[model samples]
Target chain A: MNTNNSGHSVDIVEVTKTFANVTAVHKVSLNIRKGEFMTLLGPSGCGKTTLLNMVAGFETQTSGAIRIDGKDISDVPPFMRETGMVFQSYALFPHMNVFDNIAFGLRMRKLPAKEIKAEVERALDMMKLSGMEGRRVRQLSGGQQQRIALARAIVIRPKVLLLDEPLSALDKNLRLQMQVELKELHQKTGLTTIFVTHDQGEALSLSDRVVVMSRGEVQQVSAPIELYTQPANGFVASFIGEINALPKARCQKSGQDFRFEVCPEISLNGRQPARLELKDGQMVHIFIRPEHIEIAGPRHNGANIVKGNVAAHIYQGTHTQTRVNVPGIGLVELRTKGAAAIDQAPLGSEIALSVPLDEAVILPA
Target chain B: MWRQTLFWVIVSCILFYMTIPAIVVVMTSFNPGEILSFPPNGFSLRWYEKALTYPDFRGAFRTGLIVALISSTLALVIGTSFAFLVVRYVFPGKNLLEGILSSPLIIPHFTTGFGFLLLGAHLNLNQTLTIIIMTHVVLVLPFVARAVYVSLLNIDPNFERSAANLGASPFMVLSRITVPLIIPGMAGGWLVASILSLTEFSASLYVTASRTQTLPVAMYNYIREYTDPTVAAVSALLIIATMLILMAANHFLGLRKILAIDSH
Candidate 1:
């Protein structure tokens, strides 16, 4: 047995998976760095989980190759792939207790009893389940069962660890706690983890790099902050966070600067007419974060200012959200910190709105 | 509440109806009078001793045990493999294959016996123990296959896939995971098949040789040739033996587990 201190990277090359007439995953090529926590993030039926299964050799690629440590393993069965997978449902052996669950892989490898006991105990300790060695998996809480699953997978000391929506079954608080534990566990073990989840927040929070996919195709692959700040397209941006999308017809451009054409009925200073060249006559979307738009101050010269009536105002304890009705623009949301006064800003009251041009993102038609 | 009451009433009626004949058989077997009768003057163990001394009775009992054991074991092996194929693999004419395997259950036993007799004649296997065993296996195969197949279908294929992914070979998954999980269903099917083979009469009548006369066939011949209380005694003994075997099976492997598999 080769006991090398350095870990190996997983390289998936143009892998595609098709079941009968339906294609689950299209040609997806991605190189996961050694010891990096990479998440495949997409909605249901987006093939993110399928991609993870292909890496683990649970599902074979219809076409293309997969390699671990730079050697082709597309034809290798799951048992010979040396990859550990934690399923979404945990899939712990119902007949086995915590100790046996963790020791199963070691036993399969025919390791000595003393060594298996030591490894199982160490795994239980790593998962903070030291004294839970004898408990049946069904008896454990959801979070504890999830930890047992992790312990079972990691105890095998696999070169690659594949997690398919591991935290999805846990309650929100436990999910968050496991997220931190998983990150720390990955850092300590450096096992080249490949995780799959539909939740963008999970991907952004836990991954070293996030691969965003849609309709069985990869949209973008980048660091979490880059994916958040500099999204490759509208799909990634909308899926990642809430954004107010407005028609680009309501926006004008000057050299490199752009402005919105607020309703003509509403009076505003320093507002320019939308540029003809920028308006392709087709509907284009402009996304602005709710926090980027502010209630204008009197006597302040603000760019892109709109005079509108408050259609509705909701006080949300920490922040107050108001929907202002501009004549042609319908309703635009404005979020402000610090609770607004209970008697302040009644519905249909006139107010001036200002949005910084830099904060608005122009999306393709 | 009314429905539950009605269900219990019907169940009690059916249970009473089924037990009446068994009660008569036991009562008649212990009759003090020389003749088998519904109401006995007094109880005695003389008929049991007389039934034991008869060579034909002892030989037939031994034959039934051998046939039932061999046939049930053979059926279990074949039926379980058929179930595994139907559950795990996709092939052409799968539905047709399933129908053929399960067809024995629908066919009349007399027709099956006559067909087997013809086949045995063609194969020069007339009146042989091998022929009787083979026919018995065929008679009970559908029950075993259907029971085990249903259990295999209810199990998630992902369990096996998950096992394979965790470094278990296909054989390892079958032996360690799949087989252990399905053993309850297999045992239930095997028990039913064994009981069926033990009491088999119509097929055994045609296929069994003089040296291989099973208990049921031997009892039929004894009743036809001689009108005596010894036949009732032997019938009672067979029923008691069957109940003992069933109790032993239930004690070792839970009846609840087997019934649960059938329910699913």
Candidate 2:
């Protein structure tokens, strides 16, 4: 922890992983900067875990190369890769106590007993597991076990830290708490980290940049805000957060501005990046976040407005999800802060909603 | 109530049926009379003294000890390694290899002894101690393999992966993790093979020269020639030896855990 190290950079160059007849990871390439917390986010079977394993040297890539800090380590074994891993199951050695578990890597390096003790104690204090080192792993609770797993990995001060859904097993409250601690740990150590998880919230909240994957291929890679505001494709737009997909919307170019005929009665203004290639009458999918649409009132006239009857108002703790059934547009869900939607627009009542042009994206269908 | 009573009665009857001869042998060993009998006329240690002093008794006892110790040690090493290989790897003919290893448990000892006798003769090593050791090793292999295999099945593959991830070499992982975890099962198998080899009569009879008779074969020959209490005295001593071995095994690795009753 005291070393004058800026952490290692990992470069995955067109790595592919296949198992027997099934290809788990398509040709994928990524460069993780030094001291960056990059997360691989995807659904199950999307090759996120496979990609992480290849970097950790647990799973060999079928083709292509992986380099750490400008050195090729594709042929290195897991133990010699110098990557610390926190497994999904925690995978704590049941036979060893917390102290021994954390001391294992140092011992493998053949460190002196005095140094191993000091390092293990430092890790215990860092993880807030100071006095619990003497206790067996099975006696600790799930959160404590996870803490020990983290402590064990980081005590060695590895070149890169690999976490495979490490906090997925904890309860909801503990998961949020651990998420904050994990972020704090990353900040304190500044270790180059690669986290693999399927939960979008964990990915968005914890990562410096999230790589969204689907069907064994990368869908998009961007910072959390950019990824949410501007998704590269339909899948990324819908997967990151709750989004209303208006499919088969035909785009019409009116001079410079793009208008999309989302429905028979609704012609919505489409907002996209300046360099995007758009053509008239092109079939495209329009994505709008639930919170992006606001309830229209008098003197608040907007560019694109649609009328719909409130189908259902589901009150969440922080906001109410209002499902509106629009004519020729099917059902569109909108998120209104607090209890405003339920009180303002009751069930089966006509409500006018405005969709801002900049808040939505029109992608090729 | 009737079913419970019937079950208890059936269990008691089976126990008595199995233990009656053993009880008779123990009782007759202490009898003052020259002939073996269940009810003793007077309690005496004369038969024990005579049995200990009998010709060739000490030599046969030594032979039994040597063969049991060597065969069980060989079986424990080879069988446990074989069990680990079968449990951990997927290779062609795995099922066939397992079948062949475990077939000895179901095959009759005398038939196995006869098979080994012919093989030993063909190799021109019929009466050597190496043949006895080799035959006994195969005879006890099935028990050791099955016991260790059961224990190996309880281990998770993640443990090995975790060990390797922690920087342990393959040999270190096996010695420090896998072997220590399966010690109870190994001890159980070792004890069983040792006991079986000690009492093995038919196999020893087929392979052993007259000068190298095991205790059981010696007892068999003595019983055929004599009608005294000396055989009973030897049997009683062997029963005590078995009990001592069991107690020692229980002390080292609790017998219940080794037997898989409480392995978890």
Candidate 3:
């Protein structure tokens, strides 16, 4: 029914899912643009998978509707929904060869054998699995199975592509490689892909737009960069990446700038062009990323300097994470580049930390 | 060294305890003497010929085969569907249904047979082939259901979901995915049910009349009346047949998988 080379758009409106007494997904609605690669990212039990299942029609919503290309299909059964999904287990028929597995959807549609074979071959070729057509599903390695699963889902070329943690099964290196292949496949097919995963890294790297969900509700739906930089709440801030939260920091409005006082001795200055949503002396929480904070010069005295002792230094290859315990603030983590910080900032050494509000978010306490 | 020797001696004694009766029956069946005796005057196939050629034995054997075939097949279909239901959906009284079906295992075959006999008599279908087949189906349904349940449990639920998501109806998912994947379990269950139904003596005795008696019931009758090695011959044949079928099942279907002994 779809003649466009680009994908059919999906509109999920006020979708809520409940299992018995437990609500897995609350009244959450999202609009996915045609050919856009969207990911539902959350921790386990955050209802990301439930929302994806609703879109694929595996799990129907308690209320509300899902539309494909402006047509509502909430009451449609999964088989009639015509949305292709790649499960977490791959779910390739263990009894069939790779070719048959990929051709299964086409065969289900009663497509001509010649056309089905051509499409399967084309999919296999795109996934770089040309010679694996005759191989059994169990024979393929984890990465190859992943590729075949992708090939199978995309070969159908349905209204939307659903992936349920497809890369979680692979080892780290293979997962990274498959992530690239997945991105390229999306570009080639232009199918409106709805990817569901709990890993923040995969969500950040793969999705055009990432939906950060928590506690059965959509915390924020934005591009990956915006999700990281401008998280709507405390949950989104901590979930997307590591950040330090200064709880109950009383804010004061002073002309064009804002100074947040943590204690009599320690204060943070907000010069980041102001969200300007806070009132004078409003109790708020400040969020600053690990990468933005730097070890301030000891002689530096002013609004943004805070005294702390180096608590720990975790040496990662790219960047060493330095933890500082400010008296008013709890353990504040900083991602200082290279191993220089490890030698420079030893344990229990008093350090003056510079807190940058350039990317910090302040929310009402 | 003494501990190892003691363990081996104990194992050998247990093995002898288990298999000596079968060895004696197999040996006794070949006795050249008309009367049943072990270490016979000379080995002869006379009893085997008699066991094969006797009219009543022949008729009983036919009945047993028919009953076993029909009952096992019926059990296979019912049990596989029931297994699918148990694995897929949860409803009220599910455990109760499972308990009632599997009660035949611990209910004593004679009691089940007696119950069936009473039902058949009340329906005025006493000792008929249909009644006997129905009895065997109820008796063997539990084993078939358990085997298929183990198999269905082993299968990834995603396979069916994946099929349904791929534009296949529930029936298509059953036909294309569920049935094919659990076929080994079905075949294994069917074979076991057939064997159990064939050798079933107490139930067969209660359920069948003289005209529709099964092999084991006929063997029981011959044992009481005639002092001959024919029953031994029949038993030897059955033992060998069952052993071969089980071994073949183990080789082909991985009996350990169906029995869930090793689980892998």
Best by lDDT: 3
Give candidate 2's TM-score: 0.87
User: What is the clash count for each candidate, in the order shown?
Assistant: 0, 0, 0
Task: Record all residue pairs in model 2 with backbone atoms less than 3 Å apart, i.e. clashing.
Answer: none
TM-score of each: 0.88, 0.87, 0.94
lDDT of 2 at B19: 97
Per-model lDDT: 0.81, 0.87, 0.88
lDDT sort, best first: 3, 2, 1
TM-score of 1: 0.88
lDDT winner between 1 and 3, please give it.
Answer: 3
Candidate 1 lDDT over A1-365, as tens digits, reads: 12134467888899889999888889899999888889999999999988888887778889989998899998888898888889888877665677987888888888999999999998988889999998877778999989988888888888888999999998899999999999888878888899999988899999999999998999999999988766667788778866666544444445555444444443222222233246423334566778878888765576567767998878898988889887667788888886662245678888878866565555555
Q: Write model 2 residue lDDT over B1-264, tens digit each, in one string.
A: 999999999999999999998999999999988776768788999989988998778889988889999999999999988998899899999999999898887788887888888999999988788888888998999999888998789776656666667777777778766787677778889998999999998878898887878899899988888888989999999999999998887775654443332323
Question: lDDT of model 2 at residue A44?
Answer: 100
B73 in model 2: Cα distance from truth in Å?
Answer: 1.5
List RMSD in Å for every model shown.
4.1, 3.8, 2.7
Runs in model 3 deviating more than 4 A are A1-4, A272-274, A298-303, B1-10, B38-42, B254-264
lDDT per residue, candidate 1, B1-264, as tens digits?
999999999999999999998888888888878776778778888889989999998999899999999999999999999998988789999999899898887887777888888999999987788888889999999988887897788666656766776788988888867786677778878988999999988878888777889989898998888766788899898898889878866763664343233332
DockQ of 1: 0.39
- Model 2 misplaced stretches (Cα beyond 4 Å): A272-275, A294-313, A325-327, A339-354, B1-61, B150-153, B222-264
DockQ of structure 3: 0.57
Candidate 1 is graded, for docking, as: acceptable
Error of 1 at B9 (Å): 3.0
